[model samples]
Target: MKEGWTWRLPCALASALLLAACSGGGARDNPDDSVLHQDIASGRAGAEVTFDGTLRADPQPVGTHEHLTVTTPAGDVLEVDHNTSLAPWVPAHAGDHVIVHGELYIDPGPRAGVHCTHAHTSSGCPRPGWVELGGNYYE
Candidate 1:
């Protein structure tokens, strides 16, 4: 009985360790981890550029504020906020590919986008400073 218990203890511990490693140890619990808050804190607002990266969406707060953290290809992070219609793309899951086009707002807060919207569409969303998207068609 003693020998069996001793072997089982180590096996149980080893199984627990393997499970923790495979589970990612709750790393995805905090969705804001991908957003580079340090850069926004250092006064790098109003700097607009095309950023492409994996999309991580926070599940909390429902759809009023669609929070998306983009991990840029160059390793920089940017958070995109869509205050408009959040029904289309809220509660996004991690690992979703996303591309954002908007100016960085500096005043009244950290570097973040205001009035930003998603660029995902069957026909492709419109680029900034060119045309507005999702409206009555005019030719």
Candidate 2:
């Protein structure tokens, strides 16, 4: 009887630890601002380009980054990604103008273009992307 109780105690502690680790934050729990309406790149996934556009929608949480859709003055649409891990995320809404410098990557659809917006603190990562929103700059 004492042996069985000892095993159950360890098992219960392990289960609690596992649940806490697995229940970390995610999009559904920490969703970004709702978009008022819907919706980067000119090339393959590692090409660097600098462009400007007007924010088409509010920021949305994607994977480990914030997703934004922007429209250039030339009427071209660009999908932008700002890594949540890189810098403190500042919320923005539609019609905000921003300038971005980043590596462009091709994705399946839905304007999924650019990424790699993380500063290279170590070697062997793609070049970081920079975003100038309002008057603040983020990399």
Best by TM-score: 2
Question: Candidate 1, which ten residues in sequence have the lowest lDDT sum?
Answer: 130-139
Global CA lDDT of candidate 2, please? Answer: 0.63
Q: What is the C-alpha lDDT profile of model 1 across 29-131, one tens digit per residue?
A: 2123234344356665554444446765552343664556666655655566654342244445577665454445555533354233543322322333111
Whole-model Cα lDDT of every candidate shown, in order? 0.47, 0.63
For candidate 2, write residues 2-61 as lDDT tens digits.
758978998999998888778662211111111211123233455566667788889899
C-alpha RMSD by candidate, in order: 15.5, 14.1
Candidate 2's C-alpha runs over 4 A off are 1-44, 110-112, 121-124
Residue pairs clashing in model 1 are none
Q: Per model, state how many residue pairs clash.
A: 0, 2
How many clashes does the backbone of model 2 have?
A: 2
